[model samples]
Target chain A: MRVLIMAKEGEKSEAATPPTPEAMAEYQKFNEELVKAGVVLEAGRLYPSSQSKRVQFNGKKRTVIDGPFTETKELVAGYWLWQVRSIDEALEWLKRAPYDGGTFEVREVIEFEGM
Target chain B: MHRAIEAIWRIESARLIAGLARVVGDIGTAEELAQDALVAALEQWPTEGVPERAGAWLMGTAKHRAFDLIRRRKTLDHKHEEIGRSVERAQESVDLDAAIDEEVGDDLLGLIFMACHPVLSKDARVALTLRVLGGLTTEEIARAFLVPVSTISQRIVRAKRTLAEAHVRFEVPGGAERIARLSSVLEVIYLIFNEGYSATAGHDWIRPALCEEALRLGRILAELAPAEPEIHGVVALMEIQASRLVARVGPSGEPVLLLDQDRARWDRLLIRRGLKALERAERLGGALGPYALQAAIAACHARATTASETDWPRIVALYDAVAQLAPSPIVELNRAVAVGMAFGPAAGLELVDALVAEPSLKSYHLLPAVRGDLLRKLGRSEEAGDEFERAASLTENVRERELLERRAAECAAQGTAG
Candidate 1:
């Protein structure tokens, strides 16, 4: 199954740049491993929530709010698409991922057709 | 035909969806494929006569479509050339039925884990679990929870996204993870059964189908982890509670309180099954887990032939065990009831008074309702009537409200007669 792993937004120091050289190297190394194992179908870092806007539709007119939003309970920092034998396998791979300062969010992508 | 298909799907959809998820590697896709297969079944079954082994037919059809999708995706992206080649090579030798049969358990468990993942908030987890495992739709879940359908939908979408983003494993967690995850799983099942057993809203007192589904899932969990005492406790509790389903409502689906229920109408078979499960839980040993202790209390009531025959002391002792194992104001409240029955109404009244200041029980209608019952027993009819009225107003369930109101009226009538 394809699982998404997100780096938490709490690692503010590394939010803009890799906080430490070692952390960056570790991140790159893990990415390399994922790519080689064919588990990493796609992976990328997300822009910090600071620059984001949540567009809310109250009727037809859309209202946009600039971050920092009230709730930072969970914010996506980065993600990886992993192909694995089962969700357990996906978790095994997640345990190996680089999480220098933040939590990882893992989820299965829903596939739909005739959309 | 639609209702029949829906009924069948409700029973079989989780397995179908889980199987599809395993093969397609994405739940969203798997659900779509499953739906596609369902649509096909709807069109074909009425004309062809529903096939024997209908579940297998759905699985086969879903699997075929899933394989086709995988093949198409692999081939469309030359990037997956190796996968494409492997799919082509495997097609000739692969037996789909064997594949489907082998992975169903993991898939179902995976789906359950996914629904119960801790990443989502508690409300979200319960909503999603009921929707997915209980085969309830968004509207049904919302109606059950007394929430807007949009809110439920958002919760589900966010929950799924959270699990996906958190990289929460679809398969059941093991060791420490399982232990941690177990609490959430147990909580979800509890909420599901609670809604079924005593619905929070709507006209009915019990949604038996929901109760049965949750009980089945609990039993499956017990089988999956035989050594988990709490799982058996939960199963036992569910089984015992389910045994009373037949007696819980009148012909018109009105509420029937435990003290007023017809003992003769209660299913002896279910009580037996429940007692057996409780025994299994006890044999696992240690202090009685919260669920087992609750089941023990239920067993006490089940064993009694009539209200007067109830072993109030044993039930009170079981409640004390439950309180020690998992201390909650609710447990304390229940313990108070047992105390009232075992000793005198005044003793229970004192305990209930202490809980009035408890923040947790402040909004819990049952606290007032129990208090009212104790008051009535103590000859404080006026106060008891007021308490019942408050409880009736607080409760959202129509049947529960009506029952409370009736109790309040009875209290008033008794006071007038006196």
Candidate 2:
């Protein structure tokens, strides 16, 4: 099964500061462990909601909204696309992440069924 | 509830067994303990929510079971005292968190090497590896391979017995021994992938689950042996090959040729992963191994936005290197196909013709198939039709045979048109 693990922004914003080399290294170490277990398919940290855009559609009329939206709690800071056997397995792997008390949600992707 | 329990077991069984094996010396007993843990989980988990650390929970249960078994054996035999001491030592080593992780990693590697030991037959190795490392049930394996569940069970049962009788050490060999054994592990992994990628005799043309299992196993192997370029190479090859799996077959399950496949249908994530793996293999290179070389060749096709844009000459060069290393008729045949694409149909047909008298190529359906393709390209439709007919007659797969016969009829029509 494939799952998307979304890392929610903590109380301190993800865009607040650049990552230190040590912090990056720690994350890399944790990622290596996941890679060793062969569950990680892809992972990336987004550039924050400030650098993003939103498009709204109403009866074929489109409206563009600028970034720096008020709903910061709904924003995802980073995510990983994982191929794990089960959601519980994904949770077990997530618990080992080096994140500093970050809230994360794991959602399964509905893959197209085929023979 | 049972399905969820089984899924958790599938995910955790290998590690659970590995942890148990660290305490109990024998794999057979370790597996039994692990199964006991699984049964306990099935009975308890729904009432008590699933454990936060399901694997560790399973490991703890299995370890307790191991202790009970060791205690029972100690009363019967004096040798259990040594095993008891080892278990104590193992328990002590788990004091540090890093030590626990390190032990699990080593134990998993030990399990892999033990399952794929060269002492077992090829079929036995595949069966045992799937059972132990891939965490697959006998029934699942049997269904995937189109064999009776009894056959798979017997293979695993016998494989375990063979390992016990041979006294195969349950640790990854070091130095030159590690390198030699690594190839056997890789061969079995690839064999499993190929069986799924191109089914030799199954009704379904592609079995994605097996391919996924192989890729998972290969990636895990690559992680353990990061310095081994061949590990990354095989991973790269499997990734690239699997990238096209969806595009490699039609909606109705007919095989699709590489050039004919819809490039847009290929899995871009897998291709990216494949390219990354290939890059790693190249960076760690001395000389390119057979798998690395083949991966490089596959990358050529993968990098091409369209079939017409493929770097055929480069592929031909890579195939030459492969031929130099392997020195097999199969390699030569592949090279001939590359030569045809790079140069011309006449040149490819010339190479294919030389292999006509080869003893190894005599019964190979691909020889006639390649000959037919080249002949068709050269506009010798009548000869091409005959070749395709011969190819169709030799193939066992109903779909492949139908494809070959369709090509023959097309060639015949083209011949009559002339």
Candidate 3:
């Protein structure tokens, strides 16, 4: 099963604070395990929502919204596309992911025909 | 009638199971449904004079079985309505011909990936691939590998359960994941072909059935991933190698060295196909990958009318490129052989001697076998005889051992004559 694991932005987050060198090393180790296991299909961190943009389609009218929107808590900090055997297995792997403090939402990707 | 049904089932089973797995979301259940369809075909087809489109007929039957299975499952109460609605929709809209034509390719690719998933052990992967993708019976797989039927069956059953419990998806990954998965798929196919090309432990020198099956899988993979140059490269390598199969073994089933084989016995059709595939790989651009480079080397041999006409320098160059890309002791060893062919026995012996102390090749029979050949060429008959004897002792295949022993005897005869 393919899953999207989104690391939600923490409430106390400063803008785009990178992990410590030791923490970065731990994350690298975790990434290596995922790669070795052939579970991680794709993964990447997002810039602070401050650098993001959203376009809304209200019927025919279009509206452009820039990042640094007030809903900082709901912003995604990073995400991973993992092909695990199950959601439980994805969660087990996620438990080992190096993170300071951030909630992750695991959602199964709805595969389409011929995908 | 039973034989006809078995033959049709062998051809259609992999796609049937793969398509069913896409719908049912479980390979185990999909295979069961496919089996049920096969049973239906056995009972109905003989009486009904066989359907015009046998594959579609089997797939349609299997899909219906899947629907029935879902309806019969008591524990899936929450999913019953949702699955029922989709199943009903599928039954209404599914055009058997269209499904067979459009979905089979992707479905088979997905099946290949799932069978070779990294979670399973290599033995399990081989057993599962032969069982599922190659459409071989457990008994057949066992016979090919020289293992007990029960062992192959057990490996297959456990492999399926592991995939089920782990929930391995029925989809091919994209990007870097696709490349990684492709390598495993290619490796499994290569292992199968290698076993067939040179039986590691069996009395027979080659198992043609395994080679055919592996070649079939490689061809199918090339079709599915036409854009992937490595897929074509692998197919090219296997095809060129398979072209020589008829001439690879003696009339009494002894191993025939490449140079000693009757060139007229080589399959020209397969050689042409291999060269075409190699062209496709080369057209894709960039420096030749390991498989492609190997295919190029094989092509040089294929182009040669006789042993003396072989472009050894070109082969040596290709091997040098392969060694640079892969950089393994095995690749280096192969390079030494090419170097010997291009240069002389002394040069090849120097390269082979350099690897004698390399720990990885310590027990590898070919290291000594190559050394024996170079020694014989250099007229060091005593040393050559000893090396061939050592190689014979180390080899597992009865035919190879015999061949090595014969070479040793010939070397001793030369020493006495000189």
Candidate 4:
């Protein structure tokens, strides 16, 4: 199974301040777990909601609006996709993920037909 | 007069609604059709007398209503040619018995997962599950959750629109996808059972109708996926816990504590059924899942003749297994209670105090309630009174609050006695 890990809004602030040497080392240590487990098929942190966009479609017309989105829950600050066996196994691995205040929404990717 | 109609509807409405959903391919429309049939039955049953098979009559009437709906919609000549053809085909081949079995048994677990799909928020999932899968009226659900009927109605409407707009498939997922969907399915079942057991904000302590509905769904899931031990485990857990419903309340409707309940009043049939399901779960050959372990714990209580005779050590062990499977602060709190009962209050207090700084326990009422019990047992009556008072205020149930307050008074009386 491929699952996504996302960060809630206001979660990127910890990354904004220049990390102390020790903080930088801690961050490296965190990423090392993801790498060592071979679960980090792909991962990245977004630029933050201030640089986001809201896309809406009314009938056939598509409108894009600038963000600094008011609805913090609508934004994803970071994401990851991991290949795992089952939801239980994925949850077991998720317990080891380094999360602070914000919640990580985990979801399974819908496999396309004939893929 | 309406009560009889309601009793029949609660049992039969899910199948009617599911079958209608299949035909109409729109849950909102399906519900409207089912309600139409319900109204017809209400008006006719008194005059005509209730049919020999009330459920079959309801299903037959609802299917005819679905046929009527499709006919009316087809008259408008919709542009979705493929959809029209499928709806027409469904209408054409409408044998009541085949259709009933087809619709009623069409992957209920899938329907549950679809209802609790990740796109919807938790509140939305709960409202939709109650309305669609549980066959509960919006007003009934509103009363159960202590929310306005309009709020529940809006949640259901929005949930259906969101699923339709998202183009969520009605079919069950396969392989890893199925496993990923388990948590949502389990959460829905748990919510269903919890509402039935404690009825969060209602005059009743136990809503037997809702318990029966959840158990029926759980049993269906167990049969559908025999290889899924956890599904059987959940079914067993619900069955065993619900078996005590007969003994859970007094004739005058006050709540009955577990130890005070008469063991003879417990439903032996349900206990037997639960034990059988648990055995099937164990036969799957993995370390018992959280639900199965909890079922084992409940089975221990069911097997014991009296509270004094309970295998507290086995229950503590089962809780330990549950903690390993789903390590939550709540589970730890429960394990501490079992440990306290098995060993002594002091041992349990050690575990409970260790969790004082655990943030998740901050708002949980059980932490204070359990702490108070331990304190009372340890003869620290003054401290116990304070804890019980705090717990009483935190709990929302009127009956539970009253019981806690009474316990607090007892603690105070014990202090004076000493």
Chain B vs. true chain B: TM-score for each candidate?
A: 0.80, 0.93, 0.90, 0.78
Q: Residue-wise lDDT of candidate 3 within B65-99, one digit each (tens)?
A: 77777666624675666566646655654655674
Worst 10 contiguous positions by lDDT, candidate 2 chain A: A9-18
Of the pair 2 and 4, which is ahead by DockQ? 2
Against the reference, the lDDT scores of all candidates come to: 0.76, 0.85, 0.81, 0.75
TM-score of each: 0.65, 0.91, 0.72, 0.64
Tens-digit per-residue lDDT, B251-321, candidate 2? 77788889999999998999999999999999995998999999999999999999999999999999999
> Which candidate do you rate higher for TM-score, 1 or 2?
2
- Clashing pairs for model 3 are A85-B166
1 against 4, candidate with superior TM-score: 1
Q: In DockQ, how does model 2 score against the reference complex? A: 0.40
Q: Place model 2 in a CAPRI quality band.
A: acceptable
lDDT of 1 by residue, B1-418 (tens): 5666665676568788877665555556667888899999999999997676677889888878877877788868879765575456446424757765656666787887778877778898888787766667888777766779999989988877787678565566788888778878988898788877775222432254456557767876676567889888888898889778768777666777898899988868669878988999989988777778888899999999999999999888888777777899999999999899899999999999999999877779999999999999989999999999999999887888998999999999999999
Query: How far off is residue B286 in model 3, in Å?
Result: 2.3
Pairs with backbone N, CA or C atoms under 3 Å apart (clashes), candidate 2: none
After superposition, candidate 1 runs with Cα above 4 Å error = A1-115, B1-11, B40-57, B71-93, B136-155, B200-206, B250-254, B363-365, B375-418
Note the DockQ of each predicted structure: 0.01, 0.40, 0.01, 0.01
- Quick one: ranking by TM-score, best first? 2, 3, 1, 4
lDDT of 4 at A87: 56
Worst 10 residues of 4 chain A by lDDT: A32-41
